[model samples]
Target: MRLRQLLLAITLVFTVAISPIQTDAILAEDMAIIVEVEGDPNKWKAYIEDYHPFVEVIHVYDTLLNALALKGKSKDLYDIDKEDFVRTIHPAQKYEVPNAAHSPSPIKPPKRNVNTPYTGKGVKVGVIDTGMDYSHPDLKRNYKGGYDVVDFDDQPMETLPTEGMPTLHGTHVSGIIAANGEMKGVAPNADLYAYRALGPGGVGSSVGIVAALEKAVEDGMDIINLSLGNSVNSPDWPTSIAVNKAIEMGVAVVIANGNAGPDNWTVASPATSVKALSVGASITEIKIPYLTIPLEDRKLPLQMLVGSPEWNFSKPYQLVNGGLGKEALPDVQGKIVIFKRGEIPFSEKVQVAEKAGAVGVIIYNNEEGVFQGGLTETTSIPVAAMTKEDGEWLLQKGKEKWAYTSYQLVKDKLAPFSSKGPVVANWDIKPEIIAPGVEIASTVPGGYQELQGTSMASPYVAGVLALIKEAHPDWGPNKLKAAVLSTAKPFKNETGSLYQPIEQGMGAIQTEKSINPEILIYESRLTFGKINEGVKEKKVDIVVENRSEETKKFRFDYPHHESGVVWDIPQTFYVKPKEKKHITVGLRVNSRKLEKGLHQGWLTLYNGNDEVYLPYLFVNETADYPKIDGVELTLSPFEQDKFKYSMYLPDGAEQLTIDLYEPESLRYVKTIVEDEEVKPGMHEGIINRGEFVENSYLVFVKIRNGKTYDSFVTEFQNFPLQP
Candidate 1:
């Protein structure tokens, strides 16, 4: 009965596409062979019952037998199978997986919250993937409802016939978003919904995705996480359109930037859609290993994991050592394989050790702390890494047969595989931010596992976005995107090379930076105008205000402008004697936009030359013009000698506020101003000065927002007797 319904469903899908089911040629590439399996239900069942010889079987293209035909075992069957089965069916096509070609795992970027709470507690995040393992402890409590789009079943419950379904890929992906603590997701407080868009084989159709997305939209999801994408590009693809619709309806869509990278790089379809938040990958530190030795050898440290706590190597789990390239490597089939870091892809070395039957793999760094590398999907063994000194000690001790065993894996810091980018193609600035993608400990089916990939990076983003959305319910993708992108510090690569905003797009997404609630910035993102070559000028008004305490002393320096042009903004501005103020910079362009090209440069603001650049992109035109609103300020006096101060300024407010406890002793006190509401061109009184004080105090002030507005201390000496 189930087979009859499945066949009927297949027929309907075939009829819907109009074109004969011309299976994509790429689908054939991964399978070993194509066999003629008669469409008749009896024959298909008989084959499965009597001769189950294939390694991996996929009922692709609705009834096509995608089976692996091994060389020796299937030879006799091929001869007889062709005569009996060939006439009953017929060879359709041939395909095979590329040599060593496999899908890449997108890295989960390391999240950087601006140090505010933004958990999407009441919001729902829908994950469209294979069925989630709802029974898993970490996910069970959060499971709202999920539909197996593949089977048209409403839930991943007992009713669905999952006879030959694929593994739990969807479950793992869902865990990355909604898994409870122990394997906590970024937005642990958010609600979860799932849609099984993929089958057991981690494959799904375009129509299924559309169906799932449409359902999610109807269900009113705040964010939709799509980990699947089409291998081949098609502009009119249904999934792309569905995702775009979801975005139009105020849903933030997070899609995988396709795991096909390191070459021929392009984010897949839905990810490529303008509305989608295409996420890439980053490497992060994960689980740690413990190495035990006698107390006397404490001075000779094993390996140190960065940002990870020290492990008591003297705990349970027996330790043993073996020499490098040794035939029998520490007999680690069920234990952690402790190996020194050296030449070759870490995956290759780990695989060899695993082939020697090692269970868990541990490679210590070649330096002092931890070293980083990527693991292959084919290797299922849990791998933990350490530092170079640890590897050396292990090598030295292996000569002396020191027992070493690691109990758990601890994350030290961000990993190296996490690809950094200022998006190359769109040049729209990609990799909006970095997150904990590599070796992250997230919930897995049945238990916890440390997984890595850009796949992991994206959900961290989705989870964080959920939190931001939770806090600012009014923020749209544009504001959220801008807040995330604009606030990221211009990060430098490992080699100290300045990372362009185009490559590490918008810099790494810093969660800590996104939830500050208040941001001081230039009202306009891109200053626009047209100016003729030679002595042309445009004055862009910049708002300056203080988000923190202390009067601001501001100046713009180190102008990085394109050739054939000279530019200038206000060289200097001030907030107040001891409070934030608003100011503007005047810009003069000496030349016009030449030859219809973009002229780009950086504007660095100096609070004593700790320079940070504000990126500018200008299109070449006949002329250019730039303008900004002037600053607004207001002050109220609480007494004849004391006043409460406040101001309203733009995001790029040139203002700072400072607090002083003592009229004279201003150096040691940790003084700060809390959230103050001041708009451009206005100020209000906030501070109060009372009675009499014996001593004087000093206070320090810095730009809490780090953008346009900043400040310094204004000396308040001993107070005189009130008149």
Candidate 2:
């Protein structure tokens, strides 16, 4: 389904649609918001009835954290915010499944060779997501009961049958944790409880998620795997704060780092919660050996790209160019048809070739680099993509009587889409660890299929944590997290360039090493907050607890390439058995010489054959952005044809611009304000919309200063201005 339809479905599930208001008077916009009201529940209910009678309360929390999910008009929110009893009012954010892909055996437990066989036998893992297909062959045995927060029913799997169904997402996540049929999950024997927080399109509001989390805790789950999140990077965001509370209550929360990657400061909220074990995606490399295509006089080995349908043919076929379409194709009957990329979709081209009786289809890139492509619909023929150069070579050598060519799985590496971090608000190195996520084959709704993204990676870790929890039932979430972080195997990309700590964290999971270690670090990472030009040094204490039977001697080393910062570590140290030792690590920064953004390095502790790594991250505060604060936008309360906005701009704001856009199509409508000098403190303006088109528009307020830009968008619906 399209995003619009999906959003509509979510809206229908939450609130009933209302007709547009018919007067010059402003209408209230319906929205999902979290309200933290002070005083007793009875008083709050009285206040809601007395003033905000139109509000619909969703969930009420009365424990350590008191919050309520209320569906009300936007104006009611403003009135509620003004009341003294309201602590904070925030719009509930929506989260979706980050889309993953396949190797399992290589990263499985047997390959890691753990000392004890751990199948997560008794662990209760709560998959707080879209809902699971409990009856799926692989998940049935381990399926325990769960609740559906969306439908307010007990059966979480009651999902609407549609394209891009949410059931597949949750099922795939569950399979990654405990599927034990055709494929094996990280913890095949772990018990699973499905919580259908998200509906049809894998779209769910923070309100539903929080309720689901509460249900998980109440269900006595040992681990909660949240393979869903939104791009709210703030640590104190309601959902994120709740996640921390869950951790405080003794549940190990594992969340996806998100797939909004290849960019910095994109790690989503909840995952940004310091207590949650955030996971990033990594690609499992499958090496295909050179295929020997037998020529009349010689057997030449050609490295060819593997095709989908992923089948091996018994004999070789003649090669032909299928051109851009079927009409341009030569008789490709029982032949391997080569097609150039462009003009049409990759799948369509393959389908056309398949109709032309081609035994296999090869799509070559229009540009450089070999791409991995697939057919949208299943075809009897095999298909694959190759580089433009390879296609050209094959075309030129068509005269050669080619016979057949063959391929193997070699190694794996990190996926490029895995989000990078040093999380926006707090420069903490995220995605604490990486796992198999690229094209991962896991259980879908009914059977099995491959899915990809950090969604897959999160469960991989959650499954691994299940094992860790089973082996060390007494360990707290922190120790379990540290075990995973410290034991992760460092990795480099295909180019041999080492992935930054922010991108891959401590690296891929080493499940075997994570099970038991002689020494345990109190924290997986450290942050040296805001280093300014005048700050000379910062010191932090790292506590090491030796869990071994014998005393251990350790040597420490810091990153050699890190300059402008000096790391002071003890050359040698000793920790008594079963005792904790605190070591002070000092960082002297030459702030004047250091680069502006976030800088990071790792400190390694070596004890004989074992090594533990602690990552340190710090931001240079000398370089800062123009601060935009207290931004507020309101449609005219009286005139109904005007937009009023106010904001506080601190520091040098070179220019400020306000543009109007049609939210549906995201098309630029007109500029309300442009290229104006914005000064500090409260600034307000009125945009008269008497001349603009009478359609709903999104107003964007943007401020630019030097190289920094800050902007905010608000919706404005203009019902044909009253005659």
The best candidate in terms of TM-score: 2
List clash counts for every candidate, in order: 121, 16
* Model 2: worst 10 consecutive residues (lDDT sum): 1-10
Off by over 4 Å in 1: 1-118, 156-165, 230-241, 260-265, 284-427, 520-723
The total number of steric clashes, by the backbone 3 Å criterion, in model 1 comes to 121
TM-score of each: 0.48, 0.72
Local accuracy of candidate 2 as per-residue lDDT tens digits, 188-293: 8889999988886677777678878877887888999999887665566667778898889889999988876656666777788878889998877644423334
lDDT of 2 at 197: 85
Q: What's the true lDDT of residue 184 in model 1?
A: 59
lDDT of 2 at 157: 89
Tens digits of per-residue lDDT, candidate 1, 272-316, equal 455567666544444444555554253322322211223344433
